[model samples]
Target: MQLGGDETRRLADFLAASGSGSVPSDTGGYIVMPTKGSPADVIRALQDLTATDRMDALAMLLREASEKPAILGDLVSRLAADERFIEKAAAAMNLAVYRQVLFRLETMIDDPTVKEGQFQALLEEQPWLFGSEYSCILDRRRWTRDEITDFVPRRTTDGRVELIEIKTPLHGKSLFNWDASHKVWAPGVELSRVVAQAENYLEKLDRNRDGILANDREDVTKMRARIIIGRDRDDDQRDALRRHNGHLHRIEIITFDGLLAIAKRVLRYFEDAPAEQCVVLGT
Candidate 1:
């Protein structure tokens, strides 16, 4: 969701105030005081919080209000009175909606009837799957010549890149085929193909880093690859899948179920964390 000018200013102000020596008081008011650092430093710290952290803070607040009936009214009143809090709350609501959409989209990942075009589109829409620190750098308007490498998402912290490849989540056929004779589920054809493709994409990016940087201005020095395909059928398959992924060095493999697990962990962070800890305000 896009923030308007006013909303952006308010969020900045809130972040600044939070970074200032603002402490939560017993009366539920912030005790704002002088901070040691420069105003610019404080602002930078506020800006350092990733998009995921902001959304998680809001989710935490929502979960807290739900669990504690007594504090619900107080929380709502505070949110209504504080414009910054309301702005954050709105963002949190948007994230929740998006999370639900991602859940629904997972069904199509495994559906054989859904074309690759549709599956790719669905994957493009959900940037959160890459975690909170990464954002999509390529869209339809600026996709690379290579079709195997679906998109490149950059890590916000270090400008490092991840080459992502997508494949349909196949049913019955696991990521690795079960070998009853050998007592192991070996990497299946689809999994091996995608892994090789991702590795190739990584090598290509490393080789053409200068040219890519000239064109897109993204860092590809510290690069890795991710392959999204298939599903874990059962406990045995899941165990074997973990062992298989362990051997891979450059490329990490994940199933649709594994992707959802990552999302769930992120959502759970908000649900479990204390509000104060979730949104830090220096004192």
Candidate 2:
């Protein structure tokens, strides 16, 4: 891979460090070279580099470990013995991956081909982005086949189920619009449709709550739903969403931008976490 300026400096530093202990010029036809060094020095060197470089090095190491299963197993066994290290490492990876997800979403938000399926898949894979209160997404049931709606249900940490509906901002309709007749912003046709569909899902699920409780072993009592869709064109529309959403009981609407803001806050918590050694690469 082509090295950037920062990476070039890192390479230079590495070369200078290993430049010592050269082979003799007249020591037979060939000589063995030293390929190992101090693990502490390696850790220090990695720490001196940027986080990106450290992650790249980690990716390489993981790939190498995958090829050598014994070492990988032993390494995991040792690392898993420390609960604190696991917590710190998990936090770091979560922050890194969330940043990446935010970047991907921001870059692809306007792409025409990327639709509900893409966003649904992304949110499902990273349910923590919704918040730590959520534990895991529930499996889609066959009952929703009749409605053909994309309702993502997640179990809360306390075992209550939450229905989440996601839509691409490419919905081609404003979520909140000025009601020229009423002289205030109100939910547009499309947004109202999604909310109604979510309520419908909730109603159906409520009716089948007992079935879900017995069969799926999930609690659906006093369930709440969140609708993720649309975009705010300006401050007025955003404020309007807040006003309208406040009127709803258990259902809420959140634009993608709002979701992004929420994700940023989650990231900030990690950014504020106590510094720890890089568990993956030994920073």
Candidate 3:
């Protein structure tokens, strides 16, 4: 589960050299390449890979290695634990591949003969459900003025001055225009319906205010509402969430497909992020 500094450096070097812009040549047990960059550069380079690119590269790498059965286990194990390699490997490995890997790793962990650290290592390599840094103000029946300021935020980080609202229909419906009278979208789910949820969250944050978004200088006062109608749901959801669109408000009313796509991204982040940063709110 843990790599020594030297090994980490070497692994980082391997990842950076194997990246898209560099050439990688297998040199016996360890890969060899010529580059003036440090190991940190390689780690950063690996992180720079787009999720799509990493997934593609990992598939090709695994497929090619599958032809050589002798080194398959070592290759796969190294790829799984290497920080520089994991994101790409997770992306590259298909759902079936991931399932198989998790099953085998779980079996290893369940064995009483294995050490606790070994079990932890297996967990580090595999994870369950994935999701984004979800943030919401839960509405409760009881509250006080003093208790309001002491409320814990739902997001991963603080000082978030924007709320992004997304509106999408259940199916692939089009939003040609907004029905001003009903305050809903035409032929699809209305922007107001989705914004209503955001508004509720805002209201929970500031119960006594007349409007959800108050013109405050300190706390978050502005929100940029987005309506993703007829948009490609799956992978597009993650992209839509990440690209905040130059505005502050960044919430999404995504279809199940879109939610699934971003769910993976959130999972990937959960797997790779630091322990302290991974604190669960309700837990």
Residue 36 in model 2: lDDT: 32
Candidate 1 vs candidate 2, TM-score winner = 2
Number of the candidate with higher lDDT, 2 or 3: 2
Q: Write the per-residue lDDT of candidate 2 for residues 1-283, one digit (tens) a residue.
A: 8999988986676566557643344556431112235757545644654555345544654566678867776545544454243345444665566679878877656676787888987776666567656656666644333544454555555566667778888446687777899898888888888888878877777788788778877665577778888888689978989898888878988888887778777667657756452232221
With a 3 Å backbone cut-off (N, CA, C), the pairs that clash in candidate 1 are none
CA lDDT, candidate 3, residue 157: 59
**Model 3 deviation from native, Cα RMSD in Å:** 16.7
Q: How accurate is candidate 1 locally (lDDT)?
A: 0.67
Give residue 227's error in model 2 in angstroms.
Answer: 0.9
lDDT (tens digit, per residue) of candidate 1 on 11-71: 7887875678453434663323233367686576457545564656656776887788788
lDDT of 3 by residue, 137-192 (tens): 32331232332221222343564433433222333343334468986434334434
**Candidate achieving the largest lDDT:** 1
The top-ranked prediction according to TM-score is 2
Model 3: how far residue 86 lies from native, Å: 21
